[model samples]
Target: MNEIKAMEKPIKFSDPLFVTLVASICCLLWGSAYPFIKLGYSAFDILAEDIPSKFVFAGYRFILAGLLLLFLFRVMSKRKFNLSGKQFSSLILLGVFQTGLQYMFFYVGVANTTGVKGSIMNATTTFFSVVLAHFLYKNDKLSKNKVVGCLLGFIGVVIVNFHSNLLEFSFSLSGEGFVIIAALIFSITAIYAKHLTGSIDVLVITGISLFVGGLALTILGLLLGGRVTHFTLESTGILIYLVLLSSAAFCLWNLLLKYNKVGKVSVYNFLIPVFGALLSALFLGETIMELKNLIALLFVSIGIYMVNRVSSRKFSNTLES
Candidate 1:
């Protein structure tokens, strides 16, 4: 038995190189979203002021993503998805918060802000998670590094709100403010989803919540006089890409979490905004070379690095204690 076990290969998911590649891919996919979503908006001819139509577009993306993920799970795992009344109710609440309300803020925020600024602002999600975790878990209490990290992260966020002259300060609630709100919601969603995972498969939770949330957005948008009839090959292709990316990225991220420590894998998250900024510059013609943008990016990156610098020894000790 020992010999046979020794002959078996270890799971690639836990291997360092494999993890790095997958984690980087996941972040890259997520980062591409910042630019692609803006492109999506332009393709569909959705105006910046059209809130209801944005809802419609976001709803469709999540709805199809959820359905596709569910189908893939069924085929790949061959596991039947079963939900109890309580589970169903919980999923509905999650959908409302995680998908419906969160995306509402995100889409609105992205639409109103430059993708470069919006992406950098969204990095606050990690800081929010760190702060929230400190309050919830004794083992996850804040350290000096965590506090400093958070301050740096916030400084980055604040810096981005300033003009090139450093004197004129302009911040939009519909843009950066809303993105920060969405980031906070995502922090909360991460905690809530972790709790729910004890009872349900992570995939199922994500799939159902996304579907229900999308349905809510679609219905709400229609109720609020939103219509999306402008569908071209480009628009349709972009929409499909959005759906596929959402499904693939979320599921892959969860899969990584399943096999690795959150600290080790999550450190790669800083790359998301980096990718977002660069890609936004590449695709949306937005520039991140401005003094404020560069400084903000540097601060945010350093802050995130500080926050997620937990060594394996520390993580293991925390779990044991």
Candidate 2:
């Protein structure tokens, strides 16, 4: 408590430096999840076709992540769970869509698609987030740059996935289509989370929602005859890493969304695919450092710049005007 009392000041989560550093770290961690999930399948001896096991695996990761986060905040931050009936229901709704259904579709979808295609489809979350924010938030309405930025980032995602024939692009209802649906669900629930954070502690919101969603997934998976049978040292280690990453990433991301314009923060989501592709290459022995990848990186960087660059200049003009 003494250490907590000596805290200097509230962090300026809106500061460009803080936002850039934290948001990038969150995206990088999320990007790493792509390869880690795939590795988890191999390590656990779960075949790609084993959908129920995939659900069980993800359920355990998030259940543990949620508990870890809840304990940390309760102990260190002295956070409480004095939620109203409405607030409690709101959190349950957020968890069901955000953590439970999103991962249910995402795990199955990614398993059936190529890594490149999965990453590309995941980028659609940003698109959905930005567009939804425009309609939902008065302050985060559509802007010229926001549209252009999204398109550029989307183009980059497409480019990175263009490994060979343009005709190679194909979509399956259970594969890429499921990924798109997951992305949409995530975007919609994230905006709802931002709304909840206006009244509730963002960390508490993240923790409770994750655990609630994970519980649902676990129960459903078990009922469907899903079992996590193999628990080797390596697979257990991977699961632990996933839990830690999800806890940290989701906590930080919720804080950012609570403080920043949803569109501004969501635009950085483009980097997930870039980091995903690069990390997948490094860990999975896929191609890397190609000309197209560099081009895609350039496009993505430029898109992020366009969305954020307007803010710095606007701040300056406000001072001078």
Top candidate (TM-score): 2
TM-score for candidate 2: 0.92
lDDT per residue for candidate 2 within 1-321, as digits (tens), equals 343333212346766667888899998999899899989999988787888878888889989999997887688777577899999999999988899999888888988787668878889999999889988888888889988988998998888878664458588989999999999999999888988987887667888889988888888888888888799899999999999999999988988888788888998899888888888888889888878878988998889888888775765575578
* CA shift of 223, model 1, Å: 1.3
Which residue window of length 10 is worst by lDDT in model 1? 1-10
| Model 2 root-mean-square deviation | 2.4
Tell me each candidate's RMSD, in Å, in order: 5.1, 2.4
In lDDT terms, which candidate is top?
Answer: 2
How many clashing pairs does model 2 include? 0
Worst 10 residues of 2 by lDDT: 1-10
Give per-residue lDDT, candidate 1, residue 247: 83
